[model samples]
Each structure stands twice: as structure tokens, then as C-alpha cells.
Target: MKRTPKTLLVLALVVVVGMAFRVSWNALRDVARAIGADHTAATLYPFVVDGLMALALVATLVLTADARRFALRVLGTYTGASLVLNYVHGLVPALHGASVDWGRLADWNPANWALVLLATSLPVGSIYFGSDLVAKVLHHQPTPAANAEKTVESVSNRSMADQGEPTPEPRVVNAVPIPRPVQVGFLKPTLPLKPMPAIEPVPARPASTVAADSVRTRRATGRVPDVARSTRPKRTPGELLQEARAASADWPDAHLTADRIRKTVHTSAEKARGLRDALIAERAA
Candidate 1:
């Protein structure tokens, strides 16, 4: 056992032993006086000591919850005997005195003092243990008012819980796979330079000479030939560049590829690349 409980148990035992000793000592002294053997000046009647013991025994029985029936019967018999003795002792003195000497009969000896203390034990024990017993009985028997209040409280709690907002379930989303970015080279050219073809100086022909040659050729052929009619229109380098610039004005320098320029400007890939370079140069300037 723990120290505190152990100490309390020991103290309780000491108190019970002390009360037993007090009761015994008083009873013994009363017995001695009745047999004409006691030397003390104390003059209390023998019945007084027994009466106090009886009261103590009754108190013990009342305080004990689980006392056996046989034990209770024995205590009851003893208490009845003590009460009868007390009445008989009191009457015998009164009969002899004609007028009872109450003071001398009930004198305060040490044993009587102890007996008085033992007698008072009943009320003290009854107050403490009797209240506990009553409280236990009350606890076992439930009240309707208390039960109704509990029912109301439980219903209100359930309602409040139901009315409370529901927590949202957490969303589980698949993580998007990020595309791996293309790594660019720092030294790569944004616009490629195209190789320009060598230009030969042509001797200028007079307008009259050009007109005479055209007329003579037409006369010789009767009309323009199918070969001449099927030939594509030849655009100047300046015209090709202007068309490429207009088509790719919104395109970044790096995005202006030869194929993109050819599609937009309707030109050869080489000429388109040259035009794209020219457009990039113009933008840089």
C-alpha cells in the first residue's frame, strides 16, 4: 500500500484500540467496585460503565454495513441487558435514600469520564456513517427529474452535432507530367546567311533594239510560244525580301526558318533564307 493509505489505516486502528481500552478500563473498574475491591475514590454505579459499552456496541453495529446477523443478535442482547442493569441500579439507590442523591450516584470518576466519552461516540459515528449510508441508498435509487434532464441534454447535443457543418473531403489529383524543355546552343545562328550567286554585267540594249527583236521573234513564231507563256514571273531580290519581311514581321528571329519564309513569301528556299537574313539584319539595325 502507498504511504498515505497505510498511515490512515494505522491511525484508524489506533483509534479503535484506544476506544476499546477505554471501555475495558471503565468496565473493569466498575466490576472491581461492585465486588468491594477497588481502592479509588470514584463512586459511579456499575451500570453506567456497562451502559456506555452498550451504546458503543450499538454505534458499531449501526456504522457497519455488512455485519453478520448472528453478531447483531449478540450485540442486541448485550445492549438490552446493559439497559436493564442501568435502570435497576438507579432504582435500588433511590429506594434506599427515599429521596435519590443524584450527585453522589453520578459522580465524575476517571472511568466514568471515559465512559461518558464512549457513550458520545454513537452520535458522532451516526452523523458520519449514517449520512454516508443514506447517500448510498439515494444514489442507487435514481430520480425521474435527473433522468429527464439527462435525456434532454443528450438530445440537444446530438442535434447540435448533426447541425454542425460537414468537413469537405480532400481532393486527390494526378500530378501533370512537365515536358522536358529543349536545350538551346548559345553560338547557334538565329538567321542563316545564304550564298549569293555571282552577278555578270550585261551590255545595255537600246529600247528600239529590244522592241525590234521582240517584233521579229513574234513574227517568226506567228504568236507567243507555249514555252514562253508557261515560264514563271521572275521577282527581284528587293521584292522577295519585302514580301518575306511582311509575312514574318510578327515572327521572332529564331523562328523565321527557310521553309516558313518560302511558304509565306512564295519564293525558292535559298532566296527565302536570304530574305529572312535580310529581315533579321534590318530589325537589328
Candidate 2:
């Protein structure tokens, strides 16, 4: 369906046909020898044609994983070389002792010259371009190695991940969910901005012991799990009190004491403001 697959299929067919012809030619040459006719010239033709086709087929397969730009270069090199060589020197050799007919070759124009050059040296060109493309693709660093390394390092990470040793579990915890303090119109206070910390998937084992389960690959809908983002820090007493005040604003009896305030306020912002006010008011008045 795709261009590469189609091209490969075509090349595969050509390789098979070319090889069949070569083998058939060998058998024909043996028959000619039995009859005592000069068959050496005919015998070599199939081998050359088949060898050239085989080179082209190999080049096409190599292009499958190569970059488009580079693959095109290699693909071009193979087709160009194979077609030329197979027609001229490869097929022409069958008539070795016969007079070289320049007029018959002229009917095909430059195709004759192309065949000669390709038979002699086009495959080396294919190898050069194909090798260059493959080398570049395999060495591409943008593709993350973490995914591949996951299989190798998974065993190593298992022990440290267990025993509550600060293992990276898929759960994100104790993260400040506030915007970073950025300069806007004025120096406005922002919720403490903490980065979305990296989370490791919690191994599906009991919290106490991690069973080395076989690595399983899963298909995901590409949503980050909430467990990977569910961390809230412990708020201070004053911070707690402010939250109570905000929630219980209408209740006049909301006291600033830890126990009373703890029951009253919630959220980081409310508690921080309430405690800051309470501490400063006592010092001033």
C-alpha cells in the first residue's frame, strides 16, 4: 500500500525473476555444452543479471527504516544502476564472440552507456548512500532512550522503588498547585509555584514488597493519571486558621487558636493571611 512497501515488493519480484533466469541460463549452458556449442558466453550472462538484481533488492529493503530524503537517494541509486547494468553488459555477454554491433545498441540511445556504467560500479554507489542514511537514523538522539532503557533498568529500579525509599511512583504528591510568581502590573502574590514534578508509576505490588512482575506494555489514551498529580503539602497552624476564617467568615466565633482555627479554616491562602495578620497585629498593638 505504502510507497516503500510497494517498491520493496516490486524489487522482491525482480530479484526472484532475475535469479530464476540466472539459474535457468546455467542449465541451458550445460545443455549447450553437451551439444558441443560454445556456451561459456551464455553461461555468464544470467549470473551477472541475477547478481545485479539481487543488489537492487537488498538496497530497497535497506531503505525501509532510512530517512525519506536519504532513502530516496539510495532508491534512485539502485534502480538507476540495476536497470542499466542488467540490459547491457549482463545480457550482452551472452553473445561474447559475436561482433559488437554499435548500430543495435544505438536504438536504445544513452540507455546503453548507463548500462555499462551501472554494471561496472552502480552498486557501490547504492551501498554508500544506504549506509549513510542508516547510520544517521540509528544515531538520532531526539528519540528518547528512556522508553528502551525502561526494560533494562526496570530491574535495577525495583529495589529502590520499594521499602518506601522515595521511589518514583506514578503518583504526584505534596506539589504546590499555584502559578509561578510572575511580574505582571504589580508585585502580586501568587500561590507558591512548584513544577509538575516527575512521577513514577506505583508498581502494582503491595506497598511493603514489590514482586518482580514481567514488564507489561500498555496502550494508554494519553492522559496523565490524577495519581500522578495528587500531592498537597502540610499547611501550618496559622495557614490552617486562615482557611477556617475564609470558610467560616460569617461565623463570628472563628478563633485564631490552632485547635479552634484548625476546625474553622481551610486552604493555604486563607490560613497564611490570617496568621500573618494575627502575628503582626499583636506586635503593633
Candidate 3:
């Protein structure tokens, strides 16, 4: 594995903690022995104090939220206890190697009683705190059900990729074609038909007279007269309806609105509305 900065830092911390623990171990064992513990109890006393502190520190780093707070409390308690014990061992020179007069400090002496109580209670406290700390750590770990779900999802994705299956595309509906307005012209009658009056024919005019008249007319008006154009015949309502139906034959039922139909068939709004209603009713039927 690559030796990252974090790895190197952890290694350095481990070395520092190991050396510190070794030094404290001797001091704590001596304190236990000085407090009237047997040889076997003195041998294991250091582990109860220093070992629990290490476990609490590890739990503090591993846990989160409330569990981390609990681990921190455990770590602080053990650390303080270790500090007090080590300090007492240093202060009382007899705890190092010399034989001490235990009978001189009677049960009535508060200092002697307190020291004995702290030394004796450590093992029981370690058992309780250590078990609770471990339970908290285990409780915070991912559940088997969650792990199984994640594993299943990953396996499914991997299998799909290995099979070279393409992701399905979304369905697209076809768009309706909108029709443009068609311009139609119609001629209106202004007057009733009348019989033509009989007239006598005049002699043919000479080319000169015709040319002179055309010149004079142009001079008077400054332009030639425009010829009249014929008007287109009007379409009946039936024809208009037929045209509207043909234009909207492919249109969707929802698109058959009055405005759209009016624009498409070049008809009046009222007529378009009627056609729209009729088309919709026919489709529904």
C-alpha cells in the first residue's frame, strides 16, 4: 500500500502512545502494589486502567454523535484516574520500592481510605465501562439488512453492465400538424339585372380620331383607365364544411378547438365553433 501522510501520522501516534503506556504501566502497577494488592492483582492492574483508556479513545474516534460523547466521557474518566494514580505513586516514595508501614495509616485516615477505595474500585469500573463502550460501538455499525440491500443493488448494476444492455428510452407521442389559414375571395351582387335598351349603330371612327381620343384621355387623367376584373364565385356552406372536414381529418380530438379550426378553414368564428363541436361529437359517438 502507498504510505500516505495520514498513515505516517497514525504510525507516529502509535509509537508515542506505546512508549507512554509502557512508562505509565510500571507506575500504575507499583501504585496497586503499594495499596495492598497481591502480586497477581498488581500485574493486571495497569491493563484495567490504561487498556480501558485506549479502548475508549478508539471508540471515541470510531463512533458518532451521542456514542462519541459517551466514549469521550469514558476516555476522560480513565485518563484522570490514571493521572491521579501515577501522581500518587510519584509523591509517595515508599510506593517505588521501600517497604511501607500500612498499620500506621489506620482505617480512620481519610487519605488512606480514599487511596484504598480508588485502587479497589478500578477493576469493577473497568468491567462496566468497557462492556458499555463496546456495546455502543457495535450498535452504531451498519445493520445486516442495509448491507444486503446495498450488495444486491451493486450486483444488479454489475450484471446489467456485463450483459451490455442499453438503457430504455422514454416514449414520445407524435405531434399534430397545425393547418394555416386559406384565403378565399367572393363577389357580391349590388344590383338587380335589367333589360338592355335598343341602340342605333354609329359609323366606324377613323384611326386618327381614336388615337386623338386616347391621347386626350391620358392627358386629362395622367394615366390609362384600368379594366374591370371579374369576381370569384362564393362557396356554399356545404362546400366550406367539406373543406374544413378534409383539412382537419388527421387532427387529434383535443386539437379541434374553435380558434384553430377557424384559422385552418378560413371561416368565421361562429362557423368554426359549430364545426368543432360537430367534429368532437362525431368522434365521441
The lDDT for every candidate, in the order shown, is 0.57, 0.51, 0.82
TM-score of each: 0.20, 0.28, 0.48
Task: Name the best candidate (by lDDT).
Answer: 3
Off by over 4 Å in 1: 1-224
In the predicted model 1, the residue pairs found to clash are none
Q: Which digits, one per residue and each the tens of the lDDT, describe model 1 over residues 107-150?
A: 45674444344443433443554454444444443347878999
- On a 0 to 100 scale, what is the lDDT of residue 235 in model 1? 85
Error of 3 at 69 (Å): 1.4
Per-residue lDDT tens digits for candidate 2, residues 47-112, read 443444444455445434445445555556554544443334345553334444532322375864
123-238 per-residue lDDT for model 3 (tens digits): 89999999999998888874478789998887787865575878799999898998977654354548765889999899999999999988884435555545544354577877
Model 1 score (lDDT): 0.57
Q: Which segments of model 3 are wrong by more than 4 Å?
A: 103-108, 142-285
Q: Is candidate 2 or candidate 3 better by lDDT?
A: 3
Please give the TM-score that candidate 2 achieves against the real structure: 0.28
Global lDDT for candidate 3?
Answer: 0.82
